[model samples]
Every structure is written in structure tokens, then in C-alpha cells.
Target chain A: MENESFYDFGGPEPEPARPSIGRLSTVVANPTATGVEAVIEECAALSRSLDGILALIVATSDGMLIHSTWSEVEGMRAAAISAAALGLGQRIASDFGQGEFHDSVVSTGDRVIGIYAVGDRHVLGVVAAAEDVTLGLLHLSARRTAQAIGRVLSDS
Target chain B: MSEIDVINFKLVVTGPFAAGKTTFIGAVSEIPVVTTETGTSEGREVKDHTTVSMDFGKVSVADESQLIELYLFGTPGQSRFDFMWDILSKGMLGYVLLVDATRPETWTDAAAIKAKFDELGDVPLVVGVNRGTESDVDKVVAALRLDEAVPVLACEATDKESVKQVLITLLINVVEQLEATVKGSI
Candidate 1:
């Protein structure tokens, strides 16, 4: 009675569900699986929904790329930039007693780059032409997209 | 009115994961260190937090004749954050590569990071073997394939004196390189 176990009532527990060989092969062949593809699709949808959006990138807080609309080299660069920007923003907020940082926007002569936190471990960067997108509109759209990206990341 | 000559130098601290770059900077910095640390996902068993982007700190050495300001920049140790390595290396006078003595498995990663920094520029580099003895220093030199000219010193990253010694060794190398460059110009 002191050493009673669930196995006593049901013999040995049924073998834990094993991944199918085909599924295992897919995972082996393409390490970036359906989850990554879903994240990429979310990025694409965000880019398509916004007018004059030049790029949308999802990157880990550590600067690893999850997905991006730009070319591989450009996306990697943007991912690093995004991570740095998010870090700096969070630092500034904490230092000044501003509470948790939500997002930051850098407006250049030709474009605006918005960096938004997606949950705690990820960030979403949106680049849009300054002339075509208003700051208010950009913020609204980007915040929504960031929330969506966060959901996809958590689900994955 | 007498004016003191002022000089500014940037020294980057980099290493493999959990090698103590942040601790080294925090121990020596005069100001509160500015860190970009995040909760670790993969290496949680070893460390609860890791630098995601960079850590910045400043220290000043002043004498009657001159004032030297050192801006210390620490980089994220993971390869995923290698992009920050290139960004932080800009305008750096020299760099210190730290290695953990207890974790031999990270030596390969440290060596790879060393090679990457070598490709980034011709800046002077010093290897600080943290929490290590003199024997460990020799092992680090061999494992990292360091040149005879490079300084490899045993250090405790959490100790101010030990961290200062590593910085002084690196500064010496930087000064030597500068002197050589000036001589070549002459």
C-alpha cells in the first residue's frame, strides 16, 4: 500500500504516443517545422495588411531570426537591430521608472521602424514608408500584429 | 590655466555562454552597469539569465598629467547573438576574451568566437581564463590556438583586482600596437 502505483491497477501504462516515422523524417529533413512556417505566414500577413510596409520581422530577444519578409541577409541584420532596439528601450524604461516598456518607434527621413515586444522572449519589427503611413496608424497596426505574432509563437 | 590631456578608449569583453563577461564588467565599472539580460531558455540549468544584446559600463583612470576614460562593452555569448559582436567591435581599441576554467566543453565555442573576432579586425586581444589557475591558462592558450604574443592570464571575473589586471594587460597590448603604427608612419 505504501508503494502503490497507477501501474498496479492498469498493468504497464500504454506506450506513450510515438511520433510517426513520416513525421520524424519531416522533422529531421526540415528542422524548421510547421511552427516556423506559421510564424512566417503571420509575418507575411502583417506585411500584406499594412500599406507601404517595407518589412516585417520576428526575432528572438537574443537576436535570432524567427521570420522576416526581407532577404535572408537583410532579415538577419534587421533581426539583430530589432533585438538591440528592444533591449535599449526596455533599459530606458526601467532606469526612468517608466514601468514595462511596450514599444518604441524610430522615425527616419524616409521610413519608420517600430519595435514591439511580442510576449517576453520575442520582438516584432515593422518598417514602413514615412510618407505613406501615419504614426498613429502604424502603431495601431503594429501592436495588433505583434499580439498575433505572440500568439503564434506561444502556440508553437 | 593648465589643461589635462584626455583620451577615450573602447574595450570589448566577449566569451562563450556563462563565461562571466557581465560579471567582469560589473566588478570594474564605476557606474551602474547597463545590461540587456533576458531569461535563459536553453541554458537555464547553468544560468537563469543571459545577455541578449550588450552590457555597457565606464571607468576612468586619472592622473595629474592625463585622464583616460575606458568604455567597456560586453557582448552576448551565444552564437545567435553574434550580430551584436560585429556591432560592438566597431571603434574598439582592443578586446578581452574570457573562458570559464570549469567548463571545458565551452572551450570549442570560445575558440570559434575568437576566430570570428580575429576576422572582424586587427585589434589587440587578451585571453582571461576566469576561475582558473596558471595551468588552466596554458590549456586555454593551446585550446584557443593563441599566439605567443597574446597575453593569457588566470583571473576571477568577480574580483576587481583580477579583472583590472586583465584590462591592464590588454591596454598594454593596445598601447604597443599604437606605438608600432606610429613608428610605421614615421
Candidate 2:
């Protein structure tokens, strides 16, 4: 049951936010034998594709932020909370037999973001312009990134 | 009393703002309803991630032999939360669309709710024509194009007896549907 908030998905746009230093454990911009490095590159590229930046946060199954695109203003706190919620949601659904939790999307006109499950240990989060992107695109891009990122998330 | 098995079912109570979803849930729930106001939400003018999510309530029906655990989630009517509804409605059995009798246009939300529920499957609905004030009940019934069989009733969300009656009506309808399905399976 989906409700479309009668509001439009646009407002004063956010300044183009680039990943900054935070508790986010930045992975090798170029990955090695494991594909984790490649996934980080994809996360950066995915942000570039939507004319927005991405935040890739790895977390312990227990809801602690492991790594992120490391923003300057907003940090891993949001991702940590999101990962916790996603884990809870997945547990609730799986107890009832819903699909492998794909992702959670949170949007309001100014910006829209997604949280995805990469294997079992981490969530891949991305934010894009509300008007510029669609859920379909975000899901596809996030999954591709998760595929590579999930394999090597805990390696480092 | 027939042997009543314990079942976990999901149900949704939706309507326009101030239509009394929270009140209705409170009235029927056996436990004190717990809620949190978050900054993040959908369809509102404010789109901050910090805003809260929607409202929810739970009721346990333990009548001697029958123990049914029902989770009644109250969806935020504002447009932004619209995206969450699809995921919320999945696997739910019925919808209780609380309509404000005074706001005729609010029926539009009911239609939107019905269309979305239909996508999941044929869901039994209980359209509660919530009277904001003393109202001509007939007008509320006429505005809602309810099938001859669908249940439509007048009630006050804050009134305990009235709310329970509405729930009982729905429970009976669901049991009836299940009985039919069980018969067919035989």
C-alpha cells in the first residue's frame, strides 16, 4: 500500500555534497583481489551518474557504522540508524517470509536516498535529486554496487 | 467454543489527517498504544530525514480459546509517505479506511487506498464514516460507493464501544471469508 504524499519532489536543492572525512572507513578507491574496491568506485560513479554524491556505509550486523562516503556535515549517524532499521525490517519480513530485503528508500522533495543490503554485513546508501532520479534507477545502481561491495566489506 | 488457532495478521487503518486513525487504534488495542513522532516523513512540506515515520498499533484478541495477534498500522496520509504504503500493504488482509464525514473530498483518499489494496489482491475493507461532529449519516454512506455487501458504518474514533463494534464487524467478515476458503480447499 503506497501513499504518494501530495507534495512535489522539489525544493531548494542541496549544495553538491562530496564525500568528506568521518568515521566512514574509506575503502581502496581501487579494489584488489576482492571486488570491494571496485564497489567503492561504483558508489562514487553512481553518485556522479545522478548529479549527486553517494554515501557507502558498511556496518556490523549489530547496527554500527563501519564505513561511508564520509560526508563533511552529515555523517555515518544516519546510515547507522538506517542500517539498524533495515535489519529490523528484514527480520520482521523474513519471519513472515518477504523477499531478501532489497533496500529502503526515504525521499521528500529536496532529496531522495536509498539503503541496500550488501550480503549480510553492510548497507549501501545513495542520495540523488528527487526530480532527477527514479527508484528503479537507484535500485539497479545500488544493487550493482552492493554485488561488488558485499564481497569485500569485512575484509578490511 | 471452537478451537481458535493463534494467527498473526497485518491490518492497516488509513484516512485523511485528523481522521482518527490513531484514536481508532488506541480504542481497540488491548495494550497502551506506543508512538514516536519522528522528523522524517513522506508527502509533507517538510522532507527532512530526521522527521518521524507513520503511526502504528497492535491488538491481541485472546478470548478464552481464540488468540489472534493483529498488527494495525496507521499510515501517514501526507503525500510523502505514499511510497511506503505499497510495501506496508503487502500481505495485509484488510484495510479500515477512516473517512471524515465532513470532508467529502476525503473520499478520494479512500479510492486511492482501494486501488492500491486491489494491487495486492481482493482485500476486504471496512469504511468507517467517522463523524467529526453530529452529522447526517446518510450523506457519508452515499458519498462512499460501497458495494452492496461491503461494510460501511458510522462511529466516533474516541468512543470505545463504537470502535469495538466496527472491529467486530471486520473480524466476522474475515472469518467468513476464511471459512469459504477452507471449504473450497476441502
Best by DockQ: 1
Q: Write the per-residue lDDT of candidate 1 for residues A19-112, one digit (tens) a residue.
A: 2111111001211456566666666666676777876777766454566665444454455467668766776677676698789988889778
lDDT of each: 0.75, 0.58
C-alpha lDDT of candidate 1 relative to the true structure: 0.75
Show where candidate 2 strays beyond 4 Å: A1-156, B1-4, B32-52, B132-136
Cα lDDT tens digits, model 2, B92-146, are 5677878877667767776676666667556677878887443535565556666
Q: Give the Å error, residue B69, model 2.
A: 2.0
Clashing pairs in 1: none
lDDT of 1 by residue, B1-186 (tens): 147665656678999999999999999987556677889999899999999888777677677986666668799999988877866665567899999998999999999999999997788999999999999998988888889999999999999999999998998888788789879999
lDDT of 2 by residue, A1-156 (tens): 111332222321232332221221112122232343444555666666655433445444333333445531123234334544565567656756666777777886767778777776566766667676777877887787777676665453
